[model samples]
Target: MTTGRYLAAGLLAATALPSAASAGVTVTGVSGDPGFLTGRIIYTPGGIGGNAGTTSADLSIGRMKFTGFDTATAAALAFNTYCIDIFNYVQNGTFDLQTFTLGNAVKEEQLKALLSNTAGLIGGAATLGGKKDISAAIQLAVWEIVNESGNNGYSLSGGLFQVSATHGSAATNARALAQGYLNSLGGWSAQPGFNFSMLSAVSPANNQRQILFAPVPEPGTWALLIAGFGAVGGAMRRRTRTRLAYA
Candidate 1:
């Protein structure tokens, strides 16, 4: 019986351990004068016991001039090859983040193509190809657009750009993606071609200031813990009762 109890306790403890896949997303690329920058933007999901994750990777771009189209929407509409979707919604729009999986391969491909085209047309060389796994898609979306220029930041042709992605709590994979990029860059900083922000708001969920990684413990976890303690208490109480009876 003691061995069985110990086994249960061990299992419960194992469940509480953080997984390698849940480490969160990170961005490592170049920006301003110093160029090289790496940071994490933490994220927390809503609802009781929801999962959390963070974006540690940071990038910045500035003074970008475009010639292909005026706005991201125009570029999308005009160039179907890239297939850019435009909207103004903050929570549930085309870019709204519902989960961390973001298992939309088609959308990912579209994003890559669009960014590549934008870079080429803007006369900016593709120093680093922006590629992210399914887990880091939301962070991928943020890096695709944001303010970074000292005087002028990353805004759409005519208006501010806002978009988000959603995924399940089980799919926190930002760390893996960031490591992939960093490996590709040979541990070098300052791409010398792009600009970056000062670790400001990276996600609409206010990811710039905190670490949004890892899910909350389930109610079952607490229940199991309480039940385990109750068992131990019951065992002690029975021993006391027997001693009193003997006396």
Candidate 2:
């Protein structure tokens, strides 16, 4: 059996974590219907495969082709897409065990609804006169909610859960869409509740390692970011930077 690992290249520009951060299910690969973004969280019942250290989840996006709008030009889009999130149940100092099972049917129902509402929503247009495929784009935004209260192998001990995601570039936008969905309910938030931590993208050679998407930004860097934002805004806006730090 092939153990597939996702490519961690490019940058995704989405909301930063509290300076911290963080799926697929298999009934033989669950796919969202055409024109809608579909996602599933599958459990092995005996826990996930591989290591005994930290348990991590991942979403895979296949390369897609797109075409320009007016000129009808076709081009392959290499988006730096990121911005999906996973949760471990340790919110604040207490143990929130909500990570075990997938949230009730409400979660699944809402996601399907999202796809329906966003139907026919294309990014811009594919170049080369070809239509753009957003299937991978949609998968990039899926998340895993392990154990309900969010505690897991890739998390800290006690009620201290973890969240992770890719930071910088197009990944950020993907993360934003996912965040909007999570925040819509009075349910999930990095502040006031769950703690977040961004995980370094696993090296491509080590396909055994699966990387989970989170809110972006390392846990310790949140306050620094706020200060940096203010400092630059008070004077002249600083130049934006890009990093291929997916690993």
The TM-scores, one per candidate, come to 0.18, 0.30
lDDT measured at residue 74 in model 2 versus the true structure, 0 to 100: 20
- Mind sharing the TM-score for model 1? 0.18
lDDT of each: 0.19, 0.23
Candidate 1, residues 65-107, lDDT tens digits: the string is 1012212222211110110111110110011111221134433
Model 2 off-target regions past 4 Å?
1-4, 7-52, 57-103, 122-137, 144-171, 184-247
The positional error of residue 81 in candidate 2, measured at the CA in angstroms, is: 17
Cα deviation in Å at residue 171, candidate 2? 4.1
**Which parts of model 1 are misplaced by more than 4 Å?**
1-138, 141-170, 173-175, 186-247
Tens-place lDDT digits, model 2, residues 79-136: 1222222221100010011121123454433333333333233333363111112433
Q: Where does the lowest 10-residue lDDT sum fall in candidate 1?
A: 3-12
Clashes of 1: 34
Each candidate's clash count: 34, 71
Q: Model 2 scores what on Cα lDDT? A: 0.23
